[model samples]
Target chain A: MTNKLAKLIFYLGTLISLVLFLALTFDTHRQIQTLTHADQLSEQVVAGKRVWHKYNCNDCHTILGFGSYYGPDMTKVYWRRGSEGIKAVIRSPEKFTTWRKMPRLPLTDKELEDLVAFLQWTSEIDTQGWPPQDQKLRGAPGRAVTLGVSPGAVLFQEKGCFACHRLYGTGGQQGPELTHVGSRLSYETIEKVLTDPRSTNPQATMPPPMVSHEERDRLAAFLAGMK
Target chain B: MLLAYSSQRVAYPYFLVALLLFLLQVVVGTWLALSYAVTMPQWLVDILPFSTTRAIHTNLLVLWLLLGFMGTTYFMIPEETEREIFSPLLAYLQLTLLVGTGVTAIVGFLLGWTKGKPLLEIPFPLDYLVVAGALIFLFNVGMTVIQAKQWTLIQGSLFGGLVFLAVMYLFNLPFYANLSIDWYYWWWVIHLWVEGAWELVAAALTAWILIKITNVPRELVEKWLYVELGLFLFTGIAGTGHHYYWLGAPKYWLWVGGFFSALEPLPILLMVLDAWHYIRNRRAGLNGRLIFTLAVGMSILHFVGAGFWGFAHTLPQINYYTHGSQVTVAHGHLAFFGAYVLLNIMSFYYAMPRLEGLAEFDERRGTLAFWWMSITMMLMTLAFSVAGVLQTYVERVMGLGYMTAQAQMRFWFAILVVLGLSLLGGVILTVVDLLTLRPALAGAKKA
Candidate 1:
């Protein structure tokens, strides 16, 4: 009777071991699939990474919740700007004529393209609408935003608008208010104002033509809807 | 050879230089503050030379503090290590390099070779040389520690403080073309070195000075020293978080920045409490100007003013408005002047009598200068804080532009200018007391 009992216990232990092995194999297969789920980065994106690392860009400027807090966040840079506009700005920082100036570095064409690619990847990474401050023109008759775009809004944040301009009730007072910019100007006029902002007034302190066409339209619409 | 009495020989020269530097810093700083009030007066602008003056004010504060520290370290290291300083010649060389590099950097800044960065404003290649000088000093001190078998807790704190100061400085490199990035890392170097590491050194220095000067028990002083260092390490790391409140960081940082920064005062409080405990128990009747007392008091004030101001704006909600405003200047003034500068002054007093083998000097003069300087600095900080608040309300909250706000607050700015002049007067008085008056011991030595 004792011999029979021993044989039954041995058989049960073997069965349990086989079942555990099968379960481990299944779990390993699932982990492998999950690990491969992320898409492979293209060559352009890889090149951009090289430039970013070489410059130690991450040491100061944060992107997509990475890098240091020493400079302005660049996560939404691409969404706010297009490829050609960013290219121009990178080539000649004269595009960004503001009080807070970024010194022009001697970057090669290849390096600039890679940096832009990095910026492009940054702009698309779902920030959940961060840094969403608006721009308002003081004492303007109307606002100019229309067509589901907020040109003035984009203009405010992008131009470091808060540095000199204020929305509804906040920001520096060095410049005029722009809350009513959309109502005061048509889309084409807004475009003209953007290209040569000083054309409206010779002594105007405003900088000229920093936005691309699509961004200008979108930003104008956002401002128009502000009312 | 240990300077049993040779310290007296070096006393007058150091005091003279330190006093002159102090007075010059105060005058320049006051003039600059007044210019903001007076709408940038042409004569004042030309005389003060804003760009160069700013550099001088900051650099003088740094240099004087360093001179004091080195002088004290030269005396204290050998005593604690139970051996003479590794090389007195090297010590002098380090001082020469520091002064030489410092003068060149200041001149370069005036010529507009400024990296346009504060604190780390020196042109690129020179910065490396400064680092090299620091390494040489570190080597001398490190070798001295190894030769001496006596490695006390105080020595450990001092060594740790120096190492961290050097490490903090290494990160001040210009990795980005953006000036803001440069400023950010500059503060990391300056703030961490002064606010953080300096506090640790202060605790160690206070313990050693008190033990030597008074009847305080060595064991008790050592115990408090460890306690103070604990507080420093806990708060210092988190204290640097205050500088991160702005600079386009994520909002979540407000939690770490604000909460941890609030604790920065604890170490300083411990320092003050420990000093008081020692004084209370001592039987020496506290001879001389009680310079150590003033040093401890100033260190505590540093914690209150710099650390508190840091807490005030560290919250994202608050920093979003106060960033780059005069409130920052208020904090800067108190933190740098109140803590490190005052401690240096006190250290000078302690070392001066000992080095010169002079009789105890009049405590009344030092006590008076201490009170005058501390009070005036506190008042100046208050003025800046008030002006800063008004600026924030008018410029940010009220949605007025920068020019309009500046135009509106011309009167307050004028008052600040006048207040700044008073601060300069305080500096003059302190320098006079420190430099001109010799104790009876000096006469005895000459006789």
Candidate 2:
């Protein structure tokens, strides 16, 4: 292409990208509005919202693609997992996978019911076919995944965790000397503690479980075998 | 061994004070990171105390960086301007006022005396003092440049940075709002000053240090200077889109923010390549190899650590998920500390001993400080970035609440602890080296 034509094409491309990005952002905004309106939501769903914020749910999960993206997009979670499967997982996340685990949070029955309603409500929304590809099970079924090695390592690096905890005698000093925790704790125990460590230890001050089962398992095993 | 020269040795006391403050700031930042590693407080859900810690960490970073920058600028402007300072007395007074006022403001913030803006959290009254200090600095550097009439690119660059900073700061102050347009103007200063004007200042200092140490051609340095400035202006202004992504602002910001931020790395890339090229050409001619190496290394970091990683989150789409998460922290950690503060430290290594007539000072100590600082920060940046991305996954994508996400993120915090300790080791070594080298270099010949 001639320089002028190439320049024109580049500008056109830039303009198109800009337009598309704005459209996506607007869609996100719309989703947020839909998520926030309480009149249409059930009391259980409202109570679940309270639980989400009280625990700072945005710390781990993205709803409508706007919060966190650690475990799964919980927006359509109920539909994906199905209500019965989700309730079962909620009852005992450890039973779902031997390798992957989530903290069994101590939610009251009402809270659990509300949380289920919230998840169900979330799953019913029009997500414009998100999940572009299935991240869970990595587009395959029944893979007992631990942490993927280097990506997990890269995740460790990217998260600034290396600033504090040492794996195999490397990193920072402000937290529990995690030089040997992997061998100390099973993936189940690790998942249990990570989800809500206050239940495990009242004085434990570690932040709430902020990662997904896969990431947790990946990081857990990485640290677990650190001898 | 005293050679006749106009410059006097910068008092060791200034560095001593700067070091102590830096140590304190690092401790706070470490604590803040720990807070992130765990959960937010349940009871004191008030933004007051946590906000104070945030302000303190951010403000101290700005102050110390400024102190170091100003000290370097004071030494550099005179040399580049070819004149003595217009008023050394005023410079001292300005320093005292800034340190005093800054400490008071932070104290006030902790005591619930803030306007409650995220970055512009300092109460309205104290801002006047900051402006006063900035103006005095501008006058000192500005008059020196004018008097010399031999305005080099470095001087032009610093002057440009200072001028823009003043204008932006003034524009950010909202005199009327109860909340004072807290978040809006916060970006004016935070987004504009740090990413916008600071790049100009950092590039200017980096190029000047390279020129002085390597005695590289001024023409080449000046050309790089313009390219840096152009890139800074283009990306810096447009980069405001990143901040607007979540602030209930215009949707068009995503496009503007992403595209501009993506381009933000260009100047840094150019800077890194040019520095390498300059060093490769001048290595045989350069005498003080350590300073040359530090200056060049600083440039490369400006690109890879700051520029490349910054581009990773420049898009509003990415930022939509990443905003206020560990990912943002990752970018901020690298860009602010890696590119900007590291570059300032490079300036100090290049100019401090020379301006102080301690050219033969223990290059070993300086070299150690250089490596310790670089390695510690590099590791820290890598950790923060990794932690941030992981944190994003746990917190944003995973459907875990903030507290829950933080619990999982403790793994990353473990890494931060390691980096913190490394930084601690580095800081201690820096202090020791600075102390030992001072007395040792006391008797060295002035060039």
Candidate 3:
């Protein structure tokens, strides 16, 4: 093509694409408030964001799928770890031993609270189903059927029970083993433990599981049958 | 040296500082790769955390690349406009401000001071210095072009790209309480600078160098430059959508990002073909063999790393899984090295001999450095790609925990550390070769 034609194409194409992008940007701004639940953006969450930046968290962990990949994506972390778990980790990252170590930051209690609030707010944003559910967890119900176990077996996986409790020597060691819990405790006691670990032991570090009354019954029954 | 204008010497210090920073970046990058490969002791973690080191690594890349670009502009504009620079004092001052700010920022990061957005992590106070430096550069170049009252398309493209680059930095200055809003404009600076403004500058520089080495007609080279940059902006502006896909943006971005970014490779392909055609049919006597080879090599890798590798994941379907994984890391290393890093190094190779008053010099050491760096970089990219795919499968797909999956990927990280060390060796060889190069006994001196 001639130089003039190329120049014309360059100008026209750039102008058109830029204009379209601006238009989309405008529309995005309009829709983002509702999509991100902007009304829930509290002063504390905003402070939490500053805390995040001040500590250079994004350099390690990604939020909204932007930033470095050294740590786990924190987009859905609130749902996975809960407020207390997140605070505990941040309070003393060095204490939580893992394959990679998180630097211990000296954060005030208020900063920890704000950071959790920020993460909780992020968890509520509509990411169009990002951080896709793990295939193993998604397939747990089917595997439960294959194993002839109660639906609670699938619930155990979905609820991240394996992170703290072991049944067949496949889970974490922070919590007591439930392999023969049926012989040690009845279904009623098991249900109470699921509902309120603090009730069983005031010093319990486990946050109360966020299950419904029915889910607690099923989980208790599933554990009671372990014998 | 037979410089057309004495002021072109301003580029010399810029090139020197850029090379120093480039070497530093590689060293820090190697340390980072090693961190992933092996666990660090508590004392080291306390002193230099991964986050701090990572910030330094990336910030150094930006600082050095910008210096290279500025140095290149200083070298080219006086020749293009047929006049001396507007003010060498301002140019040197700009460099000092930039390098000073870079040093302070690195030190600050170690001291736990940061604004903490990924690439734009210079503390809030230092950012103003960066802006001031940019403005000074723009003013210096702008005045030089205006005083001459004569401009070529290549000169126009370079100046326009520089202006676009400076204006784009404004988007990075604002603070948005909402993260989605923050990232939305953040991509404006990060994405647009690379694909949009930087491409324009690359196209202009590539065109200028092609004309110098191949003795091609200026009109023909400028024509392709126009077409290349035209195609670049057409696809790249809308291609910013790709970054928006999982960042809590509107849903339509999926289609917009996927479709537009898929077309982004077309211009890079044209660039590869254009460079190939010009090199093949050039005049019988070839000068600056190292420069020619680097230029051609840069084009090919630009296509492979930025174009092909980027296309592999630009589509939302695949990126949905790969967005924050090592897949992005794989693409990032290659794309930056192939496009910007190689381009800057090519400028160094092209200008250094001429600046030293030599008509010709031995290309053997330079050629070896090129191949060593290139091969090791590609291998490093391959290692990251393997690690990325495995991480995605085991972690994202299989639902394994992050630490668990990372444990499995340690072998690949080990490989990356080895490749990085090799790459650093190449960089050292390059620095040694470039710094030690001299005219041979039989080499002709420039008039």
Candidate 4:
């Protein structure tokens, strides 16, 4: 091709693409408020975003699939770990130690609340089904029931119990392996330990189990049946 | 044997600093890989947490690459414009400001000061210094090109790319209340800079090097440069959509991103063909075998890593499963190494001998370093890919928790750590060869 033709192609192609990109960007801006629930972007959520930056959280954790891969993606974190779970971990990351530990940051109560609020806002944004839900976890309880897995097994996965405690050959090493917990503790003792770990051993670092009495019973039975 | 212009010597320090920073980047990166494979000591973790170390690693990559680009510009512009640099003193000042800012940023990150965005984590105040440095660089180069008033297509493209790069950084400086809005513009800086601006820069540099090495007619090389970069901007600007698909953008982005990004590989393919065509039709015997090999190697891996590996997961359907997983990491390592890193190293190999006024130099050690670095990087990419695939299957597909999935991928991470150490050895070899290789004597045969 001649220089003039090549230059024309260069200018025209770049111009066309730039124009299209800007048009899409403009339309995206128009629809963004509704898509992201801009009305719900509270002061606390903004403060939480500041907290996120102040602590350099994105350096480890990804939000909206952006940032480093050192920590887990925090887009759906509000759904994965509830507000209380998030607050607990932030308040004392040492207590939630696992294979991949989150470093402890000295966040105040207000920062903790704000960060959770920001995460909540992020969870609510429509990601267009990005980070596709795990096929097994989609209707896990029902699938477990069909597969003859106990409700307690489903709760174990849902409550993220396996994050700290291992069963069989899988899971974290932070807590003792529970492959044969049924052989050691009766259902009553297991339930007591789940309800109040500090009662069983005052040195127990496990926080009080965040479950209803029925969930506690189901988990105890599941562990009791593991022998 | 001497450089065509004395002002070209200004690039020597830029290249030296870039390589030094490159070594530091690899060190931090290897440490990160080790941390992933095995738990680091608690005291070490308390002092240099993964977050701090990771920030340092990525920021170092950016800093080194920028230095490389600036050096390449300084070296090439004098030849292209047929004049001295507009202001060599200003160039040195820019370098000092940038390096100072980088050192301070690393120390600040350790002291708990950051803006917290990945890659853009060079705290708020230091960012201004970066912007100022960029402005100074632009002014100096802009004046050089403007005063020459004899613009070749290569010089024009190079200037355009530099200006575009500087302009894009403005996007990262703002804060948005909405996270979606935040990321939308964030991609403007991150995605657009890589796919759009940096591609332009790489294209010009590659074309300039090919013209110099092959003794090809300027018209012929510049023609291909125009066509290739034209196609690049055509596909790349909209290819920004691929990043938009999952970041709370409109659903239409899924289609836009998928369609445009699929075409993104075409220009890169064209680039490879363009280089091959010029290399095959060269008029003279090949000189600087190591530099030629690196240039050719850059083209091949650029196609494989950025073009092929990028296309591997650019589709929304595949990306949905792989986004934020090890799959992205796999693509990232290969793409950056193949595209930008090799380009910089190639420039160093091409320019260093001439900058030192050597007619020829022993190249065996350089060649050995080349193979070592390239092969190890390819292997590391493979290790990360295997781990990514397994992680996706276990964590995303099987619904395992993050730690459980990570447990399964430890074997691959172990492989990565070993490969990273090997890569470090290669880097050390390169540094040694660059520093210690002596000039060949007159009447001696080139290696």
Candidate 5:
């Protein structure tokens, strides 16, 4: 029994030594930029991260391909949507999307700005080749000097049609895919469906959004761009 | 049968509930597997999302195994201490509260009331109930040990595991501040409990099985038990580095994590090889040789599935490519089945039928289930391994998007679904046999 106890002690000591080794490695691996100097998140950006967690965003979205596969990868979302686009969608998402999906968490201006910063910060992480081109928009070089988030794209997500309809085979499955919607529908029919779904299909469950004629036009042009 | 009558009585409630929940866990797991192979409807996806499915599959696994651990304690402690449990009434009450709260939480998850931490998604209020349940359990078992002042090595090891499990669970109580730090601490809870504490349970249980059936001297068996405990502490603690590689932690973890975790399999390898030699060379436990042989076989499977496949992905360089890929899924399935699933089943095999007063412990239906379940799980692991590697190459190496990569691996995922269903079938049969045998024992006037 004493011999076995001695062997046990010897093994425990060896294990404790490895723990120290792991700690030593942790200290050496600290990022100089984040831990030491100017690379830290600004006070607002830090608050935005808190907002991200507060709503349990990771439940629906993958950051670096770790979380749920329900929503799009948010690793480079800042680049995909831009600052203005993110704000418009978050501000009054119900006015923008189709389904009651992606809950509208009412955020103050400061919280919105912080969330954008937080997203921008995440976009800068060295994700090691995550979220290939499908998630990003690679338009022609004629549009090289890029602009803010497109209002159409914001409306598409905000209005929740994406929840019911697939775009290039990504969203929920109830409705026809919007990826080839432009090829199948003329501009007038697209407008008609947006303004009044029952006019196009008598059994359609879609409730027409209360947006004005101009917003309806913009939404039509957005659906037209899907092809 | 050698245990105090009270010990045997307390054990029945725990084993019965655990087996029923085990069936529920397998059914949910089969659903998650089938969803990957078929196109689930959009509205259905919205209601029972893949995340919800995955959460239910994984959490049910943890809950049922935890239930089994309590069963393990109730069954083993009295035998080890040579005394009856302090209170059988508390044991029954504890099972009702634990299983009731667990079922409620599972229902809550379906309705989308989750905190959304993967594997730890049992919400806040349920966490309190779990704590209360564990404490009540610990008190009942602790009271028994206090009443009987004799302490055995097997009981000591098991008690250590239970205490550590309760303590580690409290790590989830606090709200973490940063995502990286949150994940960093999360792995400590996950890795330590799986690789550290539960190992003590495995060792004690394996030791108990070997001691009862075999002619191995108590001195020799106890000495090896110490060695298993020592090795577990050595590897499981430092082996947690494998999880820290990409969590934005230190760079040296690449080497430190990979190297130490690579060594984690050494003890399992030793335990299996030792058991194999004893079984082949000597017929010490032939009276109940069938279950004894299976218990040995599971140790080998644990070594290969958890130990071997785990090392395959632990290397920092390999993980850099395979992180979050199907490869990790493959590892998780094999490791979990080989380690915890096999270990728990072996415990039930030892305790339940004997308690049911079967004239002979080796029933043909159960033996068939064991072989069927083990074979199908290995095939499923193979399917997962091939699919994961292909996914990493196509998605990470070729820079394809997630869905496109999933499309490329469709064939393997189909195989996985088929094998998963077969394995589920085997589990159902085994659980049914366990259920019916209890009544058979009662009718025979054995209890």
Candidate 6:
């Protein structure tokens, strides 16, 4: 082939590629803008992403499994820590100095709010059901509980058992550690404790289970299998 | 070093600086590999962590390769244009500014002053210095061509590529408020550099080397050069879509990124074919030496690593499994070493003999170094590939925990540590050979 024709072919290929790039660039921008409309994230959430970038939190932590492995994954921290725990941990990470510490950030309360909102938004993205739920099993060992499959497991944390009740004997002194509650409480007794909590203990600070009968049964089954 | 022309001496500083940076990268890189293999102490890790190690390694590679390209262009430009350098003083000043700024940035990273983006880690102040240096280089080269009575395809493409490189850096200066937008431009810089501009530079450099060292006619090499450049432009520009697949971008990127990136391997394949032909039908004198051998080795090795291995994961389906896995690391190691590192080394090897009138090049050390470095790197790539595949399967597929998945990858990391040390040994040998070689009384034979 002649040199001129080769140059022409080169230009042709580049032009085609350029045309694709221009079209894709526009399409991608439009798609992302559209996502924001249907997406649950508010303006505050995106500003929270900016706060995450400002500190370059990714230097130590990962979101969606793309950053350093030093810090815990923040994707499900909203679910893991809840709104209160996330605020407490980042407000003073030095407080949780027992295992795998995170450094404290000098964020204002507003910044903290934004960062949490951003993390919450990230968790909502359809990660095609990533993190495989085993990551959420971080609290208890050998439970093999898939939270999505067993809504009761989600209820366990959402009800704030993690704040006071330890699954493997590693929680607060406010409540009895429930690691082997299966051995300790039968389904009838466990249900009675939730429905008529004073029957199990007169000094019980636990609220009665307010969920539907089926949900109560599921949570009972989840707590019963502890043994 | 006996000088033939003023422009020829310019490559020495670049090749030597690249040698130093290469040595640094290997040392830090090996330390990083060992850290992964064993449990590093927290206190020590507190001072120098894995993230810092990676940041330093990638940044140094970027710096030295940039310097190498600038230096190689200086050497090739004058020869290709058949003219002297526009201003020797400007050339030296450009090198000093770039190297000084680059070294400062690396040192600053040690002190924890960085922007924290991998590969785009040059801090705010140093970024400006880099821009100035690139502009100076462009001005000097642009002037050299302006004054020349003649110019060729190689010179034009190289200048065009350098201009693109400098212009691309401009996008990186803006701080996008949106994380998605930040990711969008970040890929523009990284993707465009490796797949876009560097392709042009590599093709031109390959053409220049083939014309000088082999019996290939200038016109034939230039023609193939255009074809390669054409492929690079097509696959490279559109290839940025591959990065958008997971960055929370629109859904159409899955098709755009995957299809174009799959085609990215074609240019490298063309390069391999061209080199094979050059080696097979070349003049006997140019067939066996260190410089010619590197030219051939790097060309084919680049295709194998960057082309073949890159295509392996460019598909969205596969990338979903391997996005941040060690499989990505595997491709990173092989692709960067083969495409940029070896490309610079090839420029050094072929340029010195012709320009400095050196004889008796380090054939033995070069060959031994080739075997050690190339073989060890390939092994490391294989190791990372295995580790990555396992990590993906266990972590993503089986729904195993991260620690459990990492535990399985430990065995591969151990293999990588051993292979990394071996690669370092070969690198040291190459550095020593380049630094101290005995030049024979007579000059190298012409092709």
Misplaced by over 4 Å in model 4 are: A134-195, A198-205, A209-227, B441-447
Q: Extract clashing residue pairs from model 5.
A: A96-A158, A96-A159, A97-A158, A97-A159, A97-A160, A98-A159, A98-A160, A99-A160, A173-B42
- Provide a comma-separated list of chain B TM-scores, one per candidate: 0.89, 0.89, 0.97, 0.98, 0.95, 0.95
Tens digit per residue, CA lDDT, model 6, A1-227: 87778989899999999998988788767776554333565789878886786665765565655555444456656655556556766665544433333445569989988888887666555443335532443544225254233557666665445544666543333457776788888978888886777997987765454467887888888878776
lDDT of each: 0.61, 0.61, 0.86, 0.85, 0.71, 0.75
Off by over 4 Å in 1: A1-143, A147-227, B1-16, B41-52, B177-187, B248-252, B440-447
Instruction: List, residue by residue over A76-181, the lDDT tens digit for candidate 1.
Output: 4554344544566556544443322233545798888877876665454322233332113321113323322344554545444445444565444545665666
| TM-score of candidate 5's A chain against the true A chain | 0.50
lDDT of 1 at A29: 38
Q: Chain A only: TM-score of every candidate?
A: 0.49, 0.41, 0.66, 0.69, 0.50, 0.55
Best by DockQ: 3
- List the candidate numbers ranked by lDDT, top first: 3, 4, 6, 5, 2, 1
**Per-residue lDDT of model 6, residues B21-87, tens digit only:** 9899999888777877787755665566566667787788888888888888888887777778898
True-structure RMSD, every candidate: 12.5, 13.4, 4.7, 4.2, 6.8, 6.6
Q: What tens digits encode model 1's per-residue C-alpha lDDT throughout B1-447?
A: 225534224334545566676777788777666555554433433333454556666777776676677667766776677666777677677777877887797777555455444445566788887888788878988898878867887888788888888888887754543222334466668767876677767767777878876778787777666656655655555455555444433333356556656777766776677777776677675554456667567757877676677667766577666665667678877877767777777777777656655556756666776777788778878877887787677765764544455555556667777777777777777777666556645443222
Worst lDDT 10-window in candidate 1 chain B: B1-10
Superior candidate under TM-score, 5 versus 6: 6
Error of 2 at A225 (Å): 50
Better by TM-score, candidate 4 or 1 = 4
Model 4: per-residue Cα lDDT over B1-447, one tens digit each: 469999999999999999999999999999899889887765666667899999999999999999999999999999989999999999999999999999999999889888888899987889989999999999999999999999888887788988889899998888888999999888888888889889999999999988888988999888878888888998999889998888878999999899889998888998888888888898877665787788888888888888998999999888888888887888888889989999998888888888877767888788898899999999988888988898788877766677777888888898888898899999988887776667765554653
What is the per-residue lDDT of model 3 for residues B1-447, given as tens digits with 9 covering 90 to 100?
Answer: 467889999998999999999999999999889889888876678678899999999999999999998998999899889999999999999999999999999999999989899999998879989999999999999999999999899998999999999899989988899988999999999999999999989888888878878887888888888888889999999999999887788999999999999999999999989999988888746555788789889998898899999999999889888878898999999999999999998998787777877677777788899999999999998999998988888877776577777888899999988898899999988888777777754543221
lDDT (Cα, 0-100) at B186 in candidate 1: 62
Quality of candidate 5's docking, in CAPRI categories?
incorrect
Ranking by TM-score: 4, 3, 6, 5, 1, 2
Compose the digit string of candidate 5's lDDT tens values, residues A52-125: 75555665566655665434566666655556556766665544343223445558888888888887776665
Clashing pairs in 3: none
